[model samples]
Target chain A: MRSLDVTKTAFSNTLRSKMRTFLTVIAIVIGGFTLTVTSGLSAGINQTVDDMLAGYGEEDQLFVMQASAMGMGEDLGPGPQPYDPEAGQQSSTFGQEMLSETDIEFIEGIDGVTNVEPIFFVSPDYLETSGGEQYTLNSLDIPADGPAMELVVGELPERDAMEITIPDTWLTMLDADAEDYEDIDPQIALGETVEIGISNLAFEQETVQAEIVGVSTANLAGIGGAPMPSYALNDELYEIQNSGLDVEQPDAFIQAVVDVDDLEANEQAIKDALQEEGLVGMTLEDLLGIIQGIIDAVAWVLYGFALIALLAASFGIVNTLLMSVQERTREIGLMKALGMSSGKVFGLFSMEAVIIGLLGSVIGLAAGLAVGFTANTLLTGGDGPLGGVGGLTLFALDPVALGLIAAVILVIAFAAGTLPAARAAKKDPIEALRYE
Target chain B: MIIRKTESIIELFMKEGVMSTPVLETENLVKVYGRGPAAFHALKGLTFEIHRGESVAIVGKSGSGKSTLMHLLALLDEPTSGVVALDGKPVTKLKPKAVSGLRNATFGFVFQQFFLNPNQTVLENVTLPLKIAGISKSERNEHGMKALEQLEMADKAKNKATDLSGGQKQRVCIARALINNPEVIFADEPTGNLDSATSETVEDILFGLHRDHGITLVVVTHDEDLAAKCQRRLIMQDGHIVEEQTGASTTTPTAARVPAAPGERPQEQPSRRRRLMKFGKGGAR
Candidate 1:
C-alpha cells in the first residue's frame, strides 16, 4: 500500500489494546527519561569542571613527578608521598620528572616560549581579614614585565606599594557579614579591600589591609591556592620580623607558576624546568587520576541503572508487539489472503514497533527533562544542606553534555522497539489465520 | 464488457506475458506439518486451475488441507516444491514481496471468519488492498464503497468492523475482497461462521459475482450444498484433489445479468443501494 495509508493503518490500531499500549510506552518512557537526565547532569558537571580547569592550567597539560622517592624523604608537589603502583602504567599520563630551573630558562629562551613566567611560592600562616574573613595565604612570584600580562587584573603590583591582588570570588563572600552573598552579576566587580594578618610576629596580630589593585580571573583555584602576582604578598611579615632581626623571610608561599611555550608540546621541557628548581610541578592532565577514578565510579552507577531500565522497557515492547500480533491474527491472514506478501506482514509489524518506540522515546524525553529539571531546582534552590555553591560542590549543565544525552535517549528508544517488530514480522500467516 | 470467447468460455493459460491468464494456478502442492519426528502430512499434492469467468468450490473437512491449500494458493507461504502461477507469472519462485504485489494486483480474498480489522471501519478494511497497491485516496474511496455496495453493506462503510452483524460483516469481507477489481478471488469457508440463511444468501451473492463480472473464483467450503452451486467442484481429501466436476453451463442468461455481486447489488438482497464505484462500470456491475 501507499506509505501514508499503511502508516495510518498501523497507527490507527496500535492502541487497540489500551492497557498494552499504555504499559509498553510507560516502560520505554521510563528507560529513556532516566537516561536523558543522568546524561544531562553528567554533561553539566563536566562543563563546570572544564571552566574551573581552564582558569589555571591549559588543556593537555602533562605533569611529570618522580615516581618513587625511594624513601629519601624528599617531597613531591603535595607532600612526601609515595608513588602509586599504577603510576606510569597508563599510556596517556606522566612525562619526565627530573627537571631543573635551567630547563625552565632554556624553555623560556626557546622561540615558542612567547611569554614565560617563572613562579616560586611560599605558603604563609592562615590569616583573618580586616573584615574578619579567614583565608589560607599563599604567595607567588610571577614575571611582571613579560608574557604573564594576559593574566593581569588592573595593574601589576608595584614593588613599593606592598600591594597584593585577590580573586573576584573573595568579594562575593561578603566578608563584612561573613555570609548571605549571591553571585547576582555576570561579571564580578573589581577594586575592593581585603585583609591579611600574620600572628604575633606581625603587628601583634594586626590585619594588614591592602587595596585590591587588581583582580585575576584566570582560574587560579585549580593550581591549589589564591594566586597573587608578586613576591611581597606577605610583605608585612618581612617588614615586621626579618630586617629587625626578630624573624626570617616568612610569607611561606609554598608554590610557584612557570610559563612555557605550550603546555602540551613542551611539557617535558617544563617538567625539566621545575625539577631543576627543586619543586615537583605537575600539569592539570597529569593529576586527573582522581578525576578519572571519580568519573568511572559515577559512570558505572549511571550506566547500570540505565541498562536495567532499557532491558525492562524492551521486554515490555516485545510483550506489546506479541500481543498485537495475536490480536491481529485474522487481519494478518486476511491481508496475506488478499495477496499481502510475507514481507509486507513483516514490515507492518516492524513498523508498529518503530511507532511504539518513537512515541515512547518522545514521551520519555519530555518526562525526563521535566523531572530532572525539577530535581535540579529542588537540590539547588532550597535551604537544604545540598543546596551549596563553590564549596567542593557544583551542579550545572553544558551543551555538549545535553546533545550526548539526547542522542543516547533516542538510540535507546529505537533499540527498545526493534525485537518485537521482528517477532511480528516472522509470524506465520497460516497460524495467524488460525489464531482467535 | 463482453470478452472474446474462443468456446464461449475462454481459458487463461498460466504462461509468461499474458495479462489475461488465470489469476491463480497451483500444481502438485503439498504441505507437511511437524518435523522428522512426527511429520503429519497436511496437503498431498493437490493440483488445480481457476480461470476467469468461473466460480469453483473446494469442499473438504477441517484437516483435509483445505486451509493449507488456501494458504499456498493465496501465496501466504512457499509450497513444498510446487509451482503456482498468478496472471501467468510463475510466482512459486517469486519472493514474498513479489507474491504480495501479485496478490494485491490480481486477486481479492474473503474468509469465513470475516477477518475484519477490529480497530478499522468497514471502509478502511475494504480500502486496505487498494491502499497497499498504491491506489490514490479518491480511487480507494470509490472502490471501497463500491465493494461495500456489492455486498449490500454500502451504508455501513464508516462503522467499525465489530459493529456489523455476522452477515453484514461477511458482506463487508466480500466488499473488501472486491475493492481491487482483481482478475481472481478466493474465499475460505466464506459462510462458515454465518447462519444457514445468511450462508445461502452470501453464497448466492458470491456466485452472482462470478457470473456477472467474469472474475475467477475459488472457494473452500464444508457444505456440499454450497459447493453444488459453483460452476466447478473440486473435492479434496487430506491435501489431495480426489474429484472434479463442471457445472452444466458457465454463462448467465442476458435477462439474469441483473447486477454483479462485486460491482453492484442484486435488487432483491439489497434494497436500493446505489453502486458507489466510480472507477469503471465493471466494478459497479
Candidate 2:
C-alpha cells in the first residue's frame, strides 16, 4: 500500500531540511563517540590480560635446575686458572659437585632432554662504576653452545676459575675510559685488569682490580625478576675476597631456575618443583593481580567523561525535536485533515529521529578519532608517568563497542524525540488549522 | 450541463432510478460543545436527506449551525446524538480511522479558506485524496489529471496552490474534490473567500459535477444567490431547517391531468429495477 511507501518517503523527506538535519546528526554522533570509546578501552584491557597468562611459544626444549643446581659461580678452584683455556673441560679440580647427589639421574630419566648441564652459581657483591652507579651481576648456566647463553665479546669463561661473565648493565656503568667502548677487538679483555669498587657504606674504602672476560645481556634483573646477591670480584685480590667470608667451605647452595619447554606452560609445575626443592620464582599471579588494578583505574576514568558527553547530546536531541514541533504546526494539521491518523504521524517523526541518530554516529567516529589521535600522540612521549603507552587505542573501531555505541545513540534519539513527536501528532486539527 | 438532459430520458424506464438514491441521510442529529449545563448546543434535532446526483445548498445566518451541521455530516466530528447514513452504511459510530478512510474515499470537501495543503503544489493538492486512500501513483496522476481537465486548470497543475489567485485556487480545489470520484461532495463556504466572478466559476463546476456525472453535492453557504441556484435549497435557523425547496423540474410534463393514472410519471419497463430505495428502506425513514 502507498501508506507504507509514504512512510519511507516521509523519513527521507524529514531529513531534507539541511540545517536542522545537520544539527540532529551532530548530536547523535557525539553520543556514539562517547559510547564507543568507553566500551572499547574496557574490552582492550581484558584481552591483554588473557594473552599474558600464557607461557612460552610453541617450539623449544627446557630443563629445571632445582635448589642451587643452576648456580654457576659457587664452585671456585685451581687457583684462578679458568681464564686460561688450557684447563680441561671437565677438570673436576673443584672439591664439591654443584648438584646434590640424586638430581643428575632423575632429570636424565625424563624424555626429550637432549642435554643437561647441571649449572651452579654464587651470589656476588654489587659492582660499582667509578661514577658510583651500582649493579649486581648474574651468571649464565646453560652450555657454551646453548641458545640461552650469548657472548657480546671475548669468549665464555672456563671452569675452576675467577674469570666470569658480567651482564650488560655491569658494562654500561663505567669510568670515562670504558665509556667509549666502540671496538671490542682492540678494546679490553680478561687478564687486562680494571679497578672495581665495593659500596658497603660502613666500610666503604675497598677497591680492587678485576679482569673482564665475556659480556652477557641478562643484566636487568628487576625486569624479568631474576635472582641476585652481593659479591665482589678481583683477580689480583681473589685470596683477600674469600678471606673476609672466612671458611674453608660454606654449605648453602639451595636454589635453581629451570628453563622449561615453555616458560608459561610449565609455570605451575615450575612453581610446584620449586616448592619441592625449597626454591621460589616470579609467577603469573603477581602479573594478573597488578593488571587488574590498572584495568579498574582506566575504566572509571574513561567512564566519567563518556557519561558527561552522552548527557549533553541527549539534551540536544530533545531541544531540536521540540523546536521542530513548534515550527511545523500547520503542516501537521494539514496532514490530519488529509486523513492521517495520530499513530502514522508519530511513526514518521520517530523515523526521522532514527535517521538523525545514524548520521550522528558516523560523524562521531570521525570527531572522536581526531581527538583521540592527537591526545594519544601527546600522551605517547616518554616524558611522563605511564608515557610511551601504545598508539591511540582504536576505541571506536571495536565491533562490540561500536555496536553498543550505535544502539545507545539510537535509543537516546528515539526516547528524546517522543514528546515532540507525540505533541505534533495530537494537536487538534480544527485548532491547528485556525493557527496562523 | 446539457448531459443531465439525456439522463432525464434514461431514468424514465427505470422506476428505481427515477427517485434516485439518497447518498446522505441525517436523523435528528445534534452537537453540543463543552460539557454539562454550560454546553453550547450547535445542532438540535436536525434531519435531512440528499439524493444521489442531487446538488443541495444549505443557507443560514452566522451561528445558525450551517458549519456545525456540515462538519458533523463530513465525519470530522462526532454528533452528540442520532444517526447519519451515507449510501446505506451507518457512519455516525465508526472509529476515527474508518471515518477518515470513508471520507477520503467517498466524500470530497472544500473549504472557504482554500485549505489546499499550502505546503503542496496544485497538482499535489488535487492528488492528496487518492494518496490518502493508498491509490497507485500512476492511477492517482490519471484521475487527478482528469479532474483538473474538468475544471479547465490542467495547464496550471504544477503551480503551488498558495501562489494562485482566489479564483484559480478554488478551481484547483474543485479539481481536488473530483479526483477521488467521491460519491458525495460537501463544501463549506466554498466561494465565501472569492469574488462574484470566482464564486460563479466554483458554482458552475459543482453544478457540472451533479448534472454531467450524477454525483451528489452539498454546500453550506451564506450567499443567497448561490443557494438559490442549486437544484435543492435549505434554510436553517439555530440548528433547525426552517425552509426547504425541492428540485426544480429538469423536465417539462408532457401529459395533462387524469387518465394515465396514479404514479405513472416514473416509467416501468422490463430492464430496470423495481421501486426499491438503494439507500435507506427498512427504518421509519
Candidate 3:
C-alpha cells in the first residue's frame, strides 16, 4: 500500500477508540507541558541575570580588596589574639584593613593587570536644597570607568566637573510640595545645585555645593539608589574631611578596581597572584555564580520530574497500541489475506503512534505557551510582584528547544510502538482469520 | 465489450483445437495441525486439477478438512508435504512476497462472514484490493465504481457497510472480489449466513460471473443444493476426497483427475516415514 494511504488509515483507526486514545494523549500532554514550562522558566531567569550583569561595569574588571579586611583570619575563639606591633600600627578604618599606596603600586605591577585605581570611600551627611530643606543622603564616588547607571532623563556627570547625579526616586523630595512622587518630572532636577554636608575628623561640618548633572533610574545593582558624585567633587570633599588635624592623613582605601586583558582566560591566575599579596580579587561572575547555580539546579530538578512523566506516558502508548492490535485481529488477518505485506502492517501501527504523539505535543505546547505568556504578562505588569524590577520576564520561550522537546516525544512514542507493531506483523493469516 | 472480447478469444482457441491448461493442480497435499503424537492431519494426500472457467465445489461436514484444503489451494498456508501449482508452475519455491503478490493479482476471496470493514463506506470496502495493489486513488475509485455498478450496488457506494442488508453486503463482497479482475474467485460458504431468497440472489450473481466473465469459481460448502449448482463437486471426508460428481446443469463433465505429468509421481497415501523425516528436521533446529 502507499505510505500516504497507510498513514491516513492509521490516523482514522486511532479515532475508533476515542476515549482510550484521549486518555493516552493526556498522559503525553502532562509530560510535554511540564517540559516546556521548565525550559521557558530557565530561559527567562537567565535573561534576567544577563540584564542585571549589563548594569555592572565591563566583564573584564574586578574589585580587589584586602583579604583580612573582612575579618577572614580574625580569631573569634573566646580569646584575644597576640597582635604584632606592626599589625597594630597599620592604618585601618571601620574595622577594615586599609590598602596603602604601596598596595596600589603593587597591583599595577602584577602581570596582565592593565590598570588599577583606588576606590575612595565617601559618606555625605545630608543634601540641603535651595529651599533649605535638608534630607539625609547616601553617595558613591563613581570612577570614570566604573559601572554605568541607567538614566531617567539626563547623562552621567562629567569626570572633572563638580557635579553629581541623583536617583529618579528623589525627584519628588527635591521639587514636589504635595508628596505626589509619580507626578514629578525628573528632568526638572537637571542642573539644580545642592549642598552636601560631611563631617571632618574634628567633628566639624564641611559643606560643598555641587550641580545635579543627571538623574538615574533605580536598579537592582544600585542597592538603595545611592547618588553618584563626580571625581573632582569627591576629591574636594575628601581633602576637606582630612584637613582637620595637624597629623597628615595617610593615603589608604578599602578597595581598588582592576582592569585586565582576556579576563575570562586569566581570571583565576590573576586571583591566585593577588592571594599571595594578601588581597582578594572578585569578578562579577564570581559574585553572581551562586545565583546562577541555584537557578540551574532548580531547573534541572523540574526537568527530572518531567522526564519521569514522559516515561510513564510512553508506557501508556505501548498499552494503547497493544490493545488496539488485539481488537483488530480479524481486520489485520483480512488485510494480510488481501495481499498487504507484513511491513505495511507494521508501518500502519507505527504511524498511529506518531499521530498520537503529534496530537499530544502540539496541544501541550500550545497550552504551555498560553499559560507561560499569560503568567509573564501578569507578573510583569504594573503593580505586579515583579513590576519593580525593570526589563524582567519570568518566562521566555525558545523555539528550538520547544521543537527538540516535541521531536523527542515523537521518537519515544515510535519506540514504544514497535513491540505491538511487530506482534501484528507476525500474525499468521489463517490463525488470525479463525480467531473468534 | 471486454466480456465479448474475452469470449471470442476463448472460442477462437477452442476452434483451433488448442487444449487449455489447468488453472490449479495439487498433488499429494498433506496438512498437519501440531507436532508429535498430538498432530491432527487436516488434509491427507488430496490430488485434483481445476481448469479455467470451471465452477467446482468441495462440500463436506464441519471438521472434514474442506476449509484446510481451500486454504492450502489459496496459498494461505504451506503444505506439510505436497505440491500446489498455479498456472502450471510449482508455488512451493516462491518467496513469501512473491506468493502474496501472486495471490493479490490472480485470486479473489468471498468469505461466509463477509469480512467487510463495517466502518468503511461501500466504495472503500470494494476498492480495497485495488488500494492494496498501490493503484492511484482516482484510478481505484473509477474501477471501484465500475465494479459496484456491475453488482447493481452503485447507488449504495456512499453508504456504510454496516447499513447494508445481508444480500447487499454479500453483493458488496462480490464487487470487491471482482474489483481486481482476478482469474480465480474463492468463495467459502457464500450463502451460509444468508436467508433463502438472499442466498438465491447471491448464487445467481456467482454463477452469472462464471458464465459471463469466464472466471474460475471454487466454492467450499456443506449445502447439497449449493453444491449441485456447480459444474463439478468433490465430496471430502476425514481429510481426503471420497467421491466426485458432476452437476445436472453441466453440458459436459470433464474428467476429475488428469494423469500424472512427466517426472511427477502418482498420488500416494501419506506415509509415516516422510512425516517423520520432516519432523526430525524441525526438531534439530
| Top TM-score prediction, candidate number | 3
> For residues B43-105, what per-residue lDDT tens digits would candidate 2 score against the true structure?
777667788778888766667787778777777777889788766557776667666666666
**Against the true structure, candidate 3 has what lDDT?**
0.80
Deviation of model 1 at B241, angstroms: 4.4
lDDT of 1: 0.59
- Pitting candidate 1 against candidate 2, the one with the higher DockQ is 1
Q: How many pairs of residues collide in model 2?
A: 14
DockQ of 3: 0.53
Per-residue alpha-carbon lDDT of candidate 3 for residues B58-153, written as tens digits (9 for 90 to 100): 777677788899999899989998899886778887767667666777789998888889889999999998888788889999999999999999
Candidate 3 differs from the real structure by a C-alpha RMSD in angstroms, to one decimal, of 8.0
Mind giving the per-residue lDDT tens digits that candidate 1 earns over A53-102?
54442443333223332122244577566664333232111232332344
Q: Model 2 reaches what TM-score against the true structure?
A: 0.63
Q: Report the CAPRI category for model 1.
A: acceptable
Give a tens-digit lDDT track for model 2, residues A1-436.
Answer: 2656466546655565678778767656766666555565555455444433332232233334333333433446648644523222212224222334244444444343334344434323555543466555322233322223334555544433445454443443443455533323323433444444443223333555445556543311112112111122222233333344434533212222233555556556645554464333333334354665677677667766765676677677778777777776766775666676677677667666766776787788667656655554455444433232322132224576666677777787788778777988888766676677
